[model samples]
Target: MPPYPYLATDYDGAAAHAAIFMVQWKREGDSLARYLVRIGEMTESLKIIQQALEGVPGGPYEYFEMRRFEGLKDPEWNGFEYRFISKKPSPTFELSKEELYMRVEAPKGELVIFL
Candidate 1:
């Protein structure tokens, strides 16, 4: 809220404190998933940001675990990308709660735990 974004660390004091933007974005491709986080720049014509993550899909499952966060600037673009690898890849099955957690009666008249 101080007109900038700050990254906190577990060591003790804040780690990265710099002019940052509120809007961040995420992107994923065949071999790379990345995030663009604005760190500094005056306008869209002079954009500067950090590539918060750029790696294969099976890389670290946490943001902080990403190793190479590089700085990039583009005078004609505005974007941000980041990924919090979820506990599971987006469930392609897209099953509803009722489908995932259900109780069933067995053929022999027994209750089955189908959660």
Candidate 2:
């Protein structure tokens, strides 16, 4: 059996290799084997988080685009304005009459929406 089944195609290759070794050595229904795979996945996730944190650029982290709306006031500050707050009403949109379908991989399972 292939470790990391067909549906797990989006996962990292190194993790899949590690899973292959675990699957080859362990019994099919072993709880400890499952726990170890979970641990390995967590470790891989932490490594990814660390790399992302290191790559992040130094900040004035907050950015807000200055937008012009009929009822809103003009922004007071030029660069990195801290006091500006704008609340605009949501714009109306027109959708086509045709059917719309969307699918997303949720945590528990696949989620689908149809309109």
Candidate 3:
């Protein structure tokens, strides 16, 4: 499996297959290898796009949930009712004090993040 959890979400596995080819053919500081990898990745991306289009679920092009604001009255000022007002306070999130580190495969190379 790839180091990143996000890569596993590729349902058709095209990206992961392309990644494997890249790892096998990539060379250090080689422009030609980089170019080849980019081409291979593009081909795989096209395949993934085609597959997604073929498997798309048919439904309404757009949908709105009027029930979200049901029974809530907006305040009117100068004949303009403010519909964007929040009905409730937003939730807050707090992170732990411990340091965190993560790394993922990027197009150019591995990307590292520290917090």
Candidate 4:
């Protein structure tokens, strides 16, 4: 179980809290910058996840069966690549452990955001 309330009323507040945290720490400037960048990416991922759960026509799962792409890596990303997978609307689950992929080629990027 998660600590935060899983109600729709709490998502935006939770996300805002997280964004503020990330932004506050973003000023550290170093690994923090990278971390902040990834956090931003994750924020977008969460938006996608929420939309997916809310009956959006196409969601991440439609493009890749997460497990199938778990070990797959992109060949051209420098940092992280936010790949969008499409799928029919469905419920969302809380994630525990998940493997992510990254691009192997020049400008390597994150190829997956597992949550």
Every candidate's lDDT: 0.34, 0.47, 0.48, 0.43
TM-score of each prediction: 0.14, 0.33, 0.32, 0.23
Candidate 3 stretches greater than 4 Å from native: 1-29, 65-115
Error of 4 at 68 (Å): 27
Candidate 4 local distance difference test against the native: 0.43
TM-score sort, best first = 2, 3, 4, 1
**1-115, model 4: which lDDT tens digit per residue?**
2223223545543232232112223556688687877877687567656644555344354544555445656432212333332221112323345643223323464343433
lDDT by residue (9-103, candidate 1, tens digit) is 44342323332444433454423233223322234213223322221124356553233232324321222312331222221236666655333
Rank by lDDT (best first): 3, 2, 4, 1
Tens-place lDDT per residue, model 3, 1-115, is: 2322224354563324222212224656588888887887787667656655665666666333345335445533212223342222212324468965555557887576668
Candidate 2 residue-wise lDDT, 1-115, digit = tens:
5544223356544333222222334455589988877787777566555654565566564333334233445333332332332122123324468966555557887576668
Better of 2 and 4 by TM-score: 2
Q: Largest lDDT belongs to which candidate?
A: 3
Judging by lDDT, tell me the better candidate of 1 and 3: 3
Candidate 4 TM-score versus the reference: 0.23
